[model samples]
Target chain A: MDSIKVFAPGTVANVACGFDVIGLALDAPGDEMIIRRSEVPGVRISAVHGADLPLEASRNVAGVAVQALLQKLEDPKAGFEIEIFKNIHPGSGIGSSAASSAGAVVGVNLLLGEPFSRKQLVRFAMEGERLASGAAHADNVAPAILGGFTLVRSYRPLDITALHTPKDLWVTVIHPQIEVKTSDAREILKQKVLMTDAIRQWGNVGALVAGLYQENYDLISRSLEDVIVEPIRSILIPAFHELKLRCKEAGALGGGISGSGPSVFMLSKGEESARKVADTMNQVYAPLGVDYKIYVSQINTEGVKVIG
Target chain B: MDSIKVFAPGTVANVACGFDVIGLALDAPGDEMIIRRSEVPGVRISAVHGADLPLEASRNVAGVAVQALLQKLEDPKAGFEIEIFKNIHPGSGIGSSAASSAGAVVGVNLLLGEPFSRKQLVRFAMEGERLASGAAHADNVAPAILGGFTLVRSYRPLDITALHTPKDLWVTVIHPQIEVKTSDAREILKQKVLMTDAIRQWGNVGALVAGLYQENYDLISRSLEDVIVEPIRSILIPAFHELKLRCKEAGALGGGISGSGPSVFMLSKGEESARKVADTMNQVYAPLGVDYKIYVSQINTEGVKVIG
Candidate 1:
């Protein structure tokens, strides 16, 4: 096919105690990218929408990823015109850039007749994240490319592991009308973490992985405590503490700042509890008079997919 | 039954990247404890053997743990005579203290007609660990009581989760004739850890949990890295780096300092691989002209149990 379109789901990274390691794909608020054959010898960002990202091929995450993937492909002379429809908002702390990057690589790979593996695709996509966020992290990219829950086991070799996720699990996300730059959010974090807090964080991370595999909701909730990152990052968001408390009161298994957030997400046992969490989170934001968007979604099982 | 005998399995806490969270029980070199109902009004340590543990109720880990359990029992007035046979060596970093404490609690609980749940028993056992290590951590105790692979999720609630363990997995442990005080081991560790190291550590921890659940041997080996505690603690053990490299070269999936040091453990894919790993590790320690003992066993499916 000369033309192809792909859908890449947004993702939630860090997943509370799993800072910089764990992430999960979402079913809504993703991005769609269309790649069409062109006579030009290089990738070009032909169109953009929903967010004011750069049109420059080198600056755009999708273009950067596609370019990286093309350089590794045996036939690097192929030309493609990319059009991006960004449904996920940038700086929402919900992996908007990852969706664009993942979608672009997936779409371009399909156009090239699938020369690279999903793991290789993820590496190329990470270059996109590096362009967007100044760090080549796979927490967002891996899940967006491979789906469900993912663990960026190590970065040196770019090892990523897909983990067990419960079918009944639901996610509730609220993107408040605020922006927290990824670089700024990251900079606010301390260079060093106390050994005490680090131990607690690792314990929760281990338990969270076990909880997912066992499909134990209570274990997941109890293990969601983020002693390391949340305490530092949540301060930037308004009513972050109350939002978490209300989300929990409304039956959220657990809630925390999504990514680096003004966006906050919660996990629940079922759709009803997820909607309840959304309602509670929205009610808090409504009183604060900030425009917000809410999504109640099951975990996205398929990550990047050919849409057309 | 007026008297009961229980055997508590030895455990490897920290499990490389897991730090103070993940642990697994072994099949051999455990502590055996005997508890008998008595007319006295309190728990007492009647006899001790195979080690230099104190016989005083408050001083001994087994006695201290049993005492803590009795305080919450309605029939606290009933006394119990405890005799401990320590087969797991002290300062071996193989949960020696935890085995004694866990075995005591399991034994006395059987003598008291099994009123408490396993979780409560672990809590009481943790108090014993505090007496031995001066820290109320439960990585070793939880696995010794819960069996298989376990995660100590939280300390405030004493939350613990039993994770899946591959049936073919094998453990190899070697304890050199050296003592690295837990206090000294802990002291040598920095109060603050670099964020880079902590991220790598937690990533490995998450992947390790995923590996156990998925039964992926390569994932297990790749995720076995420990950047937080191993570097600091391994220095206390002689030829630690060579031991690890030799163990891996001999077919160990992964290996590291068990708990604080003086002992190292490796996980292999099968019994044969475990024996190879043990042989390789022994070759390293044997040349040091130091006394050492090797154990090659499967993951203990049962924790503390009535053997007689």
Candidate 2:
């Protein structure tokens, strides 16, 4: 097996009130994918530090996307060697699987001479996602592939559209080492929400969208409040309130749990506030003895850069 | 005693996701206020017709706002005799009370030689709403008084800001005769929400704002969805699903409960679709004994107009 390349940027899903539908790509700390031409029409996979994912085409996410892309190409007689430099952790709620799926789809498609639209590539990536999450949800993959602010309207056929993202918006992500499985986190949620809560949710949703478009920081800050899921989920992550309060005090507009648990994100206007938010999150975890990784990055405008 | 006339147009409050915090003014079918400068102090009010609102100074919303404004003046000696020319119906969920309050406050304040600022007028209008609804919320009043799109940060002392509304957007409001008591409607609501729901709300909110800024109709239509409130509240309004389906079919972007009740608002691009939406709404309600009133209006850039 020789060498080839694929890259997928990190993403933030469940952004504010757009759960399961909205996501944005981050500018930094993305994974690099390299795929080499191989014989026998068979695929091989390797993560950073020689960490190997499954080789079976049906079981591996990257493998499936690659296979899907290759199938779309005529003469599936050629195979490829794939390598992923995994900067984004698997359970960070930062579009971990999305990176792999998106990277594989893009990388393999690139190797096969780009035949699909980015939206078209979404379905191939979504098929790859079903291997890990047991379902194909494009909130992560759509944004990772399309870049900018994205919305996945329909999950089945994959209707992905990129919304306008403000230029100066800064994002800070703090992933506490504790793990909360997405399935478990989802199971804990009540299926039926109260009428009052629903109204409040939509009310905040409207405000948040308006805030983003108008660049109204105060409205965005106020709209950042999530009375619905945050109260329950925050109970799972200790020091949640402390981090939020400290981040707000540190001049960060607001921050909340990233996706399901443990990882909390803070959004601010400038570098100072972003750095301050990171420091605040670090301090909150100190006494709790929870070591964590911090990501201070801008909204990723260019997603899935292939390593040459 | 000479009566001074003022007018305030109907408004849409809660503006989807900025629940209880955001609202926009409408252009037509507003309420007219007649304020008589009198020697009888402490502010007096009488409702001739419209919405069956209370006539007493304490119970009447207009009376309350007038009192709030006059009480602030030294030697609160100016008496107010208020009358309403009710165009917008009560329980229409179209910021009915806010129109009267804003108009009364504006009328009486003008009689008193313009003593307070516009923000102060919003505060004064809240007094009226406080008396009627038992809560001081400026989401509607702020916009009716100031015009355009207004964000109500708080009600106590009333923190308000105006947004620049795009020129091309048209609004279609359908008021079905079904009555859902505001107090009872509010009581059935839950105090908590899922954090995930909150994120979705903010995401839609962000999208809506972006739609407005870009004046992108399809994007605005997509962003117009109310996953949180519309779902729950529309349950109370019969044929809500059918009504929304019809509105969208008729060329409106999306439809949701206007404020808290039987009325539904559909946003459209131009005159044709807006008219079509009103017809569709009427068609939906005719079979349910929900006699309806419909308004085809622009963004209502000028919130309140003074009647000569």
Candidate 3:
């Protein structure tokens, strides 16, 4: 195949108490990228849309990820032209960059007859995130590549475990117009978390995993608490606490800062509840008069895939 | 029933990366207690064996736990005589006190015709543990009461989620002839864990939960790292590092400080591997010339139950 178009879904990272470990993919508002063999012998970002992103291969996450994937190919001379149609807004904190990077590598892998494993694809995508976020974190990228729910069990060996997610799970995400730089959102966190808070978080994280595996909605709701990261990162977002409270009151099992800030997401038991949560979140944000967008989506079972 | 005997299995709390959230029950080395109705009102410790223990119902964990159970009984005036047969030694880091507390509550609950729910029983047992350990932690006690793998999702509402334990999972526990007081074990830990170590620990915790749910032994083995608690606490135990290494090399899936220190346990895929791990651990400790006991058994599915 000369070219392939792939769509990668947006993802929610650091799900409440999971901090740097757990994340899930959203079925809507992802990035679509089209890759074709180019006459040039190197990867290139030929076009862009929706958001102003760097076109230089080395500077762009998609470009960087695709470049990493290309190096391992038996035929290293392969050239790629990429067109990015970004639907997930950049700096929205809902894994916009991850979608782009994951989509690019997944597309390039398909176009090259699929040699690398999904874990390798995740690694390549994480490196893409590294170029964008200045940190080699895989919470978002892993889910975008693997789909459903994922756990980055260990970073040293790059171990990723695909967790069991309930089929009826729905996600409601709202991205405000305000932008919170990932670096700034990360920098505000303290270098040390109180041992007490860490213990609570550990309990919640374990319970959240159990809830997902058991398909217990009440357990999931109760486990949706981020005592450490959220207390610090929520300050960067406008009306984070109010949004969370209103969302929970409106039937969201639980919600938190989607990635860093600006965008927040919640999980619900069903489509009805997810919509109700979105409506309530919109009602809360409407008075603020901040330009924002809302998405109600299922937990994406299939993460990044070939569109055509 | 006039009298009842119940056994609460010993448990491994923290489970390496899980710290204070994840734990599992072992089949052997548990505490057995007998509760008999008396004409006098209130609970009392009737007989003691195997260890020097407090007889006061309020001062002792089993006594304290049974007292909590009595408060909830329909006839608070119902009297109970308790005989404590502590097969699990204290200060061994293998949930000795938890076994005592759990066995007490389970026995009393049975004697009173099982008036409390497992969660309530866990709560009462946690209170029992509080009298033993300074903190009201439930990681060890919850599993001891509920059986199998258990996660204390939240302590505020006292939420405990019973996790899936692999049926073929075998555990090898070696208790060296030494003591690491729960208070001293906890005191040695720093109040603040480094952010990097905490992140690594969180990833492993998430993965360990996923492993339990997925029944992936390899994943569980890979996730059995304790970057935070083990580093500081292991210093108190002799040959902890070498024991862990030898156990892992002996085909053991994973192992770590059973609860705090002095006693180390490893999980294996089958009984053979478990025996192999126990032998290796014994060899490592035999050179120390200190007395030690090793128990090789399966994961206890039935936690606290009526024995006779």
Best by lDDT: 1
Cα lDDT tens digits for candidate 3, A243-299:
989988898999898888688999999999999999998899999979999999999
Backbone collision tally, model 1 = 0
- The residue pairs that clash in candidate 3, if any, are none
Q: Write the per-residue lDDT of candidate 2 for residues B1-308, one digit (tens) a residue.
A: 26678778898886766566667888876898888887788777766575676778888888888777877786656777887888988778998889989998888777777888777888889888787678887878888999887765433334466766778778888887778888877766666656455545555555565566667677667756555566667777878898889888988887577778777777888878888888888888888875777889887887767776
Sort every candidate by TM-score, greatest first: 3, 1, 2
Query: DockQ values for all predictions?
Result: 0.86, 0.29, 0.79
lDDT of 1 by residue, B169-219 (tens): 999999997879888988899999999899888888888889999999999
In terms of DockQ, which candidate is strongest? Answer: 1
Worst 10 residues of 2 chain B by lDDT: B152-161
List, residue by residue over A85-134, the lDDT tens digit for candidate 1.
99998888889999999998888888878899887899999999999878
Query: Isolated chain A: TM-score per model?
Result: 0.97, 0.91, 0.97
Q: Which candidate, 2 or 3, would have the higher DockQ against the true structure?
A: 3
Docking class of 2: acceptable
List model 3 lDDT by residue over B163-228, tens digit each: 999888999999997877877888888999788778788778778888888899999889888888
lDDT value, residue A230 of candidate 2:
76
Q: DockQ winner between 1 and 2, please give it.
A: 1
